[model samples]
Target: MTLSRRPAHRDVPETAPVAGPIRVDPRTKNLTKRLTAGDIAVINHEDLDQVSAQALVACRPSAVVNAAASISGAYPNLGPQILLEAGIPLLDRAGEALMTQVTEGVDGSVVGNEVVVDGVVLAEGTRLDMPTVLEAMEAARGNVSQQISSFARNTMEYVKNEQDLLLDGIDLPELRTPMEGRYALVVVRGYHYKEDLQTLRPFIREAKPVLIGVDGGADALVELGYRPDLIVGDMDSVSDATLVSGAEVVVHAYRDGRAPGLDRVESLGVEDPIVLAATGTSEDVAMLLADGLGCELIVAVGTHATLIEFLDKGRQGMASTFLTRLRVGGKLVDAKGVSLLYRSRISGAALVWLLIAGLLAVVAALAATPGGRTLYQVLAVRWDDFWAFVGGIFG
Candidate 1:
């Protein structure tokens, strides 16, 4: 059965909810890839961020049944709002039993705020509408100052733990690709990444920057027809195909040198993949790696740079990112900002069409005025005479 597009916020009245097949996954990212239109997405994601929410919205799911709290009121997360704005019915905090009771691919119905299967209520939760979401966002915003204070404290504590990142570009793992004095492109799968990459296409073509992908960002780069020169992350989100795709893999380990993701890399038959134990996010590690290798410029795509963006990722601290950016200094450029600043040149066909339009305008003006017509006739005769002389000489 086909489902009609959900009406806008104003149009949607108080009524029974739409029904569809249920697709369940704890991870929002994994669920996004498998979700189809008219399906109900059952996810266990807590405090859903805007990026994941946007991904879920792209799938056009009829409804979302979250096993965990969609918004824990941590810091005004944007995911729930995005989903509600897109007119997707969200039943937040549906409980773990819903995941167990609601079988995948089964005909599930969202009647009001409850998940019903085979005439039985499997789970019931609060239906997140616009007003509720907005109110929550306002409350979350009020708590932001507290979160910021906490974040600052965490950053200071982290500085004490990881001062090496600032003092000396901490020890980096040896890699096959050389990065010294070269341009580097580090991609993280966050915040309008697809659009940013689309805008950076010309830059990518011109500079051919050393492509570095953090975990699933490698898959994103591969999807965009660019092979990653280095893949650095915990290896949880990236696929096996990407691991074997010839990118030099770097497993981001804990400060104590525990490389959990290295086992996955080894299982994939990647030869001599390096492990860099660090006290920061993988994206931070990737930047430090490039900077340590003396990269002249570093372009960051989809990497979180803003305070809210960092908070959206559920980060209580930005110490490593703070230090990494300071160390890289002038070399680091955010792709979103770069895309906004970079103007694309007009295409050849577009320029040709513009020239043709200008000529037509000139011809019309010549036809409109007697003096212009006389001048045009004189120019036509002179142009023909000049071409005739050239033709005679050439022929």
Candidate 2:
């Protein structure tokens, strides 16, 4: 699944690129939520992270025009490679001024490196194909060691500041949803989350785990027809529709007790959302909440656990995640690993089909017997008489 990191300076097709309505957003995550297939995605995300790239690819856009560098060489980001590999056209570093030139839902086409509107070129930048993206990625990989060192330093500093999480169970707000002695399924809208969730369908149905969604993960659950038992996050990414979906809200605030998300929740008419002023990410808070509530087993889907994943998430450190996992211990399971090991038993539909086959075999055996012939004749006469009586009553 590794993409080749070499620039392909191949010839561009003579045919004009497909025209579509453009959707613009400075935040790639929020843009992806509204973007549909064939729409041109305009984003200002620099060093476009892998998770955001994957989200955009899933939407199947015709092209992506980034206002910032897709691969700024900050640290071998995989987003540009992912987009190029998916056969989507990418125009990199188109500049922030391009945002004002095009309105939302305005028809536009990607002509090579240029974004064309009604036969006029609005903006043009580097046209990234496979070879170019791959070459950039290869160069970026060399800087990964430096990034790792910085990440480690950040993690250590964070641990020093937030030691209470590791030693003592920090005081947390009370949750209305009970999680004790039950399986808590925490979902995040991160890497390969949609596929992982689909794979865990049987486990979700049978175990009936308490569904706890972190921010936009709540919207993901609702999209898949599962009601979230509890929704915890900073509240910036989640839609108002999800806030009103009856899930108990827990707003993650700053260590100094400033809750930016609290105002948004209040504006949405969500009354008395439990405001948790924590130092770490909302994901960390969710895990700690589950662990504190005495969940028997915690299954996590779409969570960022790896060093690269954290880096991709724009997180400088993973202090809280490391401590949270230590606290949860062996009780925690990754949804992808669970999917590989779990063997689905016979479904109800299969059992019904088997039952029908067995009944047919029995009927064939009975038909071959003389006593069965007499029984069939009696039943047939009774059936005809019943039908005649019903018909006569209707007449």
lDDT of each: 0.84, 0.84
Across 208-232, the per-residue lDDT of candidate 1 in tens digits comes to 8899999888888898888899999
lDDT of each residue in 1-395, candidate 2, tens digit only: 11122232245655347579999999998898899999999999989888899999999999999988999886778898889889888888887888877789999887776777776667777888788888887888888888778777877887788778877755767788888899999998888887788888888888889999999889888889988999999988888999999999999888898999898999888867998887678887888888888898889999988767876766443666766787777788999888876656789999999999999999999899999999999999999999999999999
Candidate 1 at 51: error in angstroms? 0.8
Q: Which pairs clash in model 1?
A: none
TM-score between candidate 2 and the true structure: 0.82
What pairs collide in candidate 2? 5-134, 5-135, 6-131, 6-134, 7-131, 7-132, 8-131
